[model samples]
Target: MGDRWHVEVDRSVCIGSAQCTHLAPAAFRLDAAMQSHAREPEGEADEKVLEAAEGCPVEAITITLVGSGEAVFPPEE
Candidate 1:
């Protein structure tokens, strides 16, 4: 998983909707703070990860290439 993408959730922006957890259970988990976190971004496929992020109501999840630090989800508009 060294070369795979990484996921991060902005705690301030997250609203504990649990949508990401529901969409990609293997990759996401609810933390003690009741925020969604990416347990293993590679646990699911790229598309699945993307889908989970897309379903986040607060748009708190952020996906990026591990080495490049480039944003993969919530892409610039």
Candidate 2:
């Protein structure tokens, strides 16, 4: 099976900074409620999308690989 990524955002923690949107415009976007949301990319997954999740100050974004169920996150500092 082809590789796929599942992205999710913790709306409770999203601060509307729009940083995710700025970083990965194709993967992250703002909803009608001004909440941040992570969507599956149309084609191949971009490393920058993961970077955006890492850059989120609130750590609200998370990315997981489908099937394998592996997840990635920014290092805790």
Candidate 3:
């Protein structure tokens, strides 16, 4: 199995601006009801995921390394 990343969003904090969708379309999607949700990135593009999280106005997105269970936000910067 591919190494996975766990993505969580505090929907209450999300303003539905869809910035994450635009920044990392491969890692995020909006459902038919327009609810934002996470999808796995197509390889080691954790940076893209991090960008989406940072781009979120409300900071609703949180990314965790699946195997290590470590937070990937604030992205090593």
TM-score of each: 0.82, 0.79, 0.73
**Candidate 3 backbone collisions, by pair:** none
Candidate 1 lowest-lDDT run of ten: 40-49
**What lDDT score goes with residue 54 in model 3?**
90
Candidate models: Cα lDDT each: 0.81, 0.77, 0.77
Tens digit of per-residue lDDT, candidate 1, span 1-77:
34467888898999899998888888889988888878875432377788989999989988887767777888967
lDDT of 2 by residue, 6-54 (tens): 7788999999889999999988889988889776633355688888888
What RMSD, rounded to one decimal, does every model reach? Answer: 2.7, 3.0, 3.5
Query: What's the lDDT of the predicted structure labeled candidate 3?
Result: 0.77
lDDT of 3 by residue, 8-75 (tens): 87777777889999998988888776667887532363777878999998888887777687777746
Candidate rank order under lDDT: 1, 2, 3
Best by TM-score: 1
On the 0 to 100 scale, the lDDT of residue 34 in model 3 is: 67
Clash pairs detected, candidate 2:
none
Query: What is the full ranking by TM-score, best candidate first?
Result: 1, 2, 3
